[model samples]
Target: MSSMLKASVQIDARGARFGALITAIVFSVALVTQSPALIMWQAAVFAIGAFRGPQFTPYAVIFRSVVKPRLKSNPIFEDVRPPKFAQAVGLVFTIIALIGSLLGSSVVFSVAVAAALAAAFLNFAFNYCLGCQFYLLGVRLVSPRNSKITLEVK
Candidate 1:
């Protein structure tokens, strides 16, 4: 990991989970309605999260301002990279969904949105972060010399 990655911020896992729930809900609505606008909205959120950092993501901001203040539980901290990676994954799927919607390919659109929704639902419902797993797998494969990358990132 680079120094920036080393210094990368941590996130409140509770807030992240809450964000996942919101993401799932949004995607669900989009999937049901087949709304390109909704997919674009989510795509924007994912882009911001992936590029600017997860804290700046729309739902994360909502959680920080509206939800976190009401919660009495202690904050569960985790490295931000995994969630950031997750956002990038979401962005990819949303883009694909948007493309499919624009091109009138129901199969592609549904599959893309559904995949993203499933990932978000998994994160929200079971705390099974598929993107985080992929990120870990990537680190393990790409940085075999730094086997501690996972530990360090976490």
Candidate 2:
């Protein structure tokens, strides 16, 4: 095959995880308090993250501008796409939760919020992103032989 490259934006893993942590906390609070307002705020964040890169999210912006200055470790970069995909997943769940809340169906809202919290917590605590895994699985299944994708930090 001819040489071809697909460049991907490299994201700082630490920053992304920090955002995940914030997301987890937000989701946790939303679930606990059953606050539709908070959930709406989170959904906006997820929408921004999904449409833009995770690096562009407000949480990530905070990490980059504030928390990052205190850390001594080198920045770790990763593909930008996966996080975006994860945000989309989060958005989906968040929308479901919102729908449930608006419809006065506590069960649907609780379940959806809990699921989102679990995913965000897993990513933050274990550095394991569930949505990213799904994306990777899809990629593997669709393009087992495709090696043209290359990562480049912007």
Candidate 3:
């Protein structure tokens, strides 16, 4: 695995965990009547983030931005590829949720919300990245050439 992917996975776990916990709390407290605005906002954020690719590249940019001796000596993040599998999974889920929401299916909406929560928890609780796994599985199944770039962690 590239160092960037590894570092982002660690950081994403943190973001997902925190984001999931708060969303779940809000969901449970409000029950089935949770605000649609909040739901859409969160979903949009995830979709956008997934689409745009890694949001944690700043670490690399920061490292490269400065010429200080200490900054140059430090090695916090490795040269890693962005987690494509995770991004694809998130994108697919987002698309599904969007379609369901448009169709006015409460069940679909709920599932989408739950999926997001699960994703967040999965990252934080188990450090099991469904996104990365999904992406890898997808690439392997669809394109052999693409699979060459995917990292398999043992």
Candidate 4:
């Protein structure tokens, strides 16, 4: 791993789930109200999480400073890269949704936001990080050649 990846901070998995839950809820509200502003706000939140890491995102910050401390159980810390990558993916979708909304294409906007919302819902409800899995698959595909790894046996 590169120093930059290694240097990434550790974050509580619970906090991450909390952030995802908050995102899902926000997206749900935005969809119901057909609020472009709310979608833009979500995009901003995802951008912050992608660029500054989860610790600096509003939901994570609130979870860390407020909810985590009040919890009775200890937090489980995990590598931050996966969630960061996920947030980047979310940012892309949200930006698409925002642009679509601004352009007055309800179909485009709804599709993009709905996809992101589904991913967030999965993460929140099942602790399944679709973005994280994609990140891992991407790393495996892009990594340097290996001697033994193969899809078929000779």
- Candidate 1 C-alpha lDDT tens digits along 64-141: 899999999999999887788888999999999999988999899999999999999999899987665787777778
Clashing pairs in 1: none
Question: How displaced is residue 17 in candidate 1, in Å?
Answer: 1.0
Off by over 4 Å in 4: 1-7, 136-154
List TM-score per model, in order.
Answer: 0.83, 0.84, 0.53, 0.83
Tell me the number of clashing residue pairs for each predicted model: 0, 0, 6, 0
> Over the stretch 1-154, how does candidate 4's per-residue lDDT look in tens digits?
5987568578888998999999999999988888889999988999999998977899988997889889998888888877888899999999999889889999988899899999999988998877657876877889986656574554
Each model's lDDT: 0.89, 0.89, 0.50, 0.88
Per-residue lDDT for 103-148 in model 2, tens only? 9999999999999999999989998866646877777788766445
Model 3 worst lDDT window (10 residues): 72-81
Which residue ranges in model 3 land beyond 4 Å of their true spot? 1-31, 53-88, 144-154
> Which structure is stronger by lDDT: 1 or 3?
1
Show where candidate 1 strays beyond 4 Å.
1-5, 136-154
Judge candidate 1 at residue 7 and give its lDDT: 91
Candidate 3 residue lDDT tens string, 30-68: 236744555565455555456653433332233234432
Cα-lDDT of candidate 1: 0.89
